[model samples]
Target: MRSRHPLRIAAAALLAFATALPLAATAQAAQPTAAAGGVLYKKINSGVSPSWYTPEFERRLLASGTDGVRLPADATLPGGVTAPQAAGLVQPGIRPGQWLLTLLGSDGSDNLLGWCSANFVFKKNSTWGLGTAGHCGVVGQPVSAYVVPPPASGKLPGLYVIGKISLSRDHGIGDDFAMITISPEFSSWMNPTMPVWGGPAGVHTGDQVGEPLKHFGHGTLIGTGGTPRVGAALRWDIENGAGYSWAGAATPGDSGSGVLTLSGQAAGDLTHIVADVEGNMIGVAGTRMTKILQVAQGWTLVNGSLLPL
Candidate 1:
């Protein structure tokens, strides 16, 4: 069992909107299950509210540690293992649309601060990184993934430390995004293609109102059952670089999940659940890819095998 620590950070203001409604960060835990081949994997189902939700929210730390069960020394690597593998053995890769856990600090404790879905894979110079919501973590917070890669050999899936939140911002709408600098060991396993929905042909800019959008997120509360959602862009605030879409519904833990155009162009990332004055969920809102690229400067979107748009 991994040792647990008390999360020390206080909740921060989630957004700057004036709607007088509860603007919750769609970041929470989901149920864990055993993977195929008897590979023991666990989802940090700890019900801790993300630190960016509200001022009065208190942290609910997980009773058990959140570390993944380690793979054995003799375990076989997954197929298609890339070069420069760790420990002279190839391992499965981490890809977009996977579940990620945000730890409190750099000490590697199993104390889960929060969890969110990964968006896209990025490359800045030679460094690789994963994209998530800015509210998912603050700068310097450690990150991990509860990966369940395809069953290969008899090796099981478990938790792994991918990287840390090197850049983050949540200045209200259109500015909620973060970048996790991927560790060298996991770089070879990085896959740019989003699970299920393929091709994010490239970074999509400009307005796309009324256009069909596709999203694959892991919000446990949204009840997606691991299936992608399709909806239309409700509106686009071009000047502010935010957009709202009715892609079914984006709930807690869905923040940072990427959205793409039907033609497979990377559109944006889910940031918050839009609500009305009475706190009724209206739609899901996110920062546009154009804005993310603009703010996350120097980082280029890594392209994957293109699929028919």
Candidate 2:
């Protein structure tokens, strides 16, 4: 007979070992899988928290090795990514509901990843933070105030290094939201509600079916009504726990925005848009902010406390 191939023999032995191993051992050997494109991706059992939840965010703050927790408030391209100096848009005073933007990818080939609205602002001890959809920016990514876009380039001004992202997770794909600690320099602009869009009525939880809903982003309002569909849309092996809008829908660049009831209670954050036609999109999807905060153990709302569901 021909000499047995070494590779075949090795494969046979490995298969035998695997077959003989106890089932529990095999299960224990499994690890969380990573996502593509290096956005700190992972897949977990449905409804379970992502790997970078409470502990990871806490550890990140400590890793900074600073007297106080902070993020880059001004533009300084990482990894030597070159872009034009940002033209200043921030003025003497800043307030909630104002637009914010993030530059995605390296400087020269940068994309206007996000041109969204700030949902809320919060403070803990002396630290200030802002809340937006997790999909807008990842943890430790730089953020800046909004400027006009499409070929979104040149030295945009009002350039201040916003604080680094402390915590963020995407809906469906991972966890669906993020919170950025505000740099003290920009803290003056912070507020609890979107005054420009509606009111400072404050945020609350649970579905507001038959209640009117409004989203403030892209410097305008998108309205929705009819019985809100609770937990209607799920994707990427994760349940959105989102209340779907029957009327208006969100489009690109609306991620991380809050879908607020007219009374000012935060219903959820815009995670994805289901359908669209000629500036009219339907079936807007978002993750419940209350549920997000419940899982976000170390985080609280801008009221300096967590809201009840």
TM-score of each: 0.67, 0.53
For model 1, residues 1-309, the per-residue Cα lDDT tens digits are 965321101001111221233334332222212222222112222234333323221122121123344433343222222212322112245766766668763233445446577888899988998898887888997677755434442434655667879999866457778999987756556778876678678877757565667777666544222336666666666234454443335555677888887778888888655554434344566788888898899998887666421
Error of 2 at 254 (Å): 1.9
lDDT of each: 0.59, 0.43
lDDT per residue (tens digit) for residues 125-175 in model 2 = 777777676756778876654322112223233334456677877645324
Q: Could you tell me which residue pairs clash in candidate 1?
A: 26-253, 27-253
Write down the worst ten-residue block by lDDT for model 1. 6-15
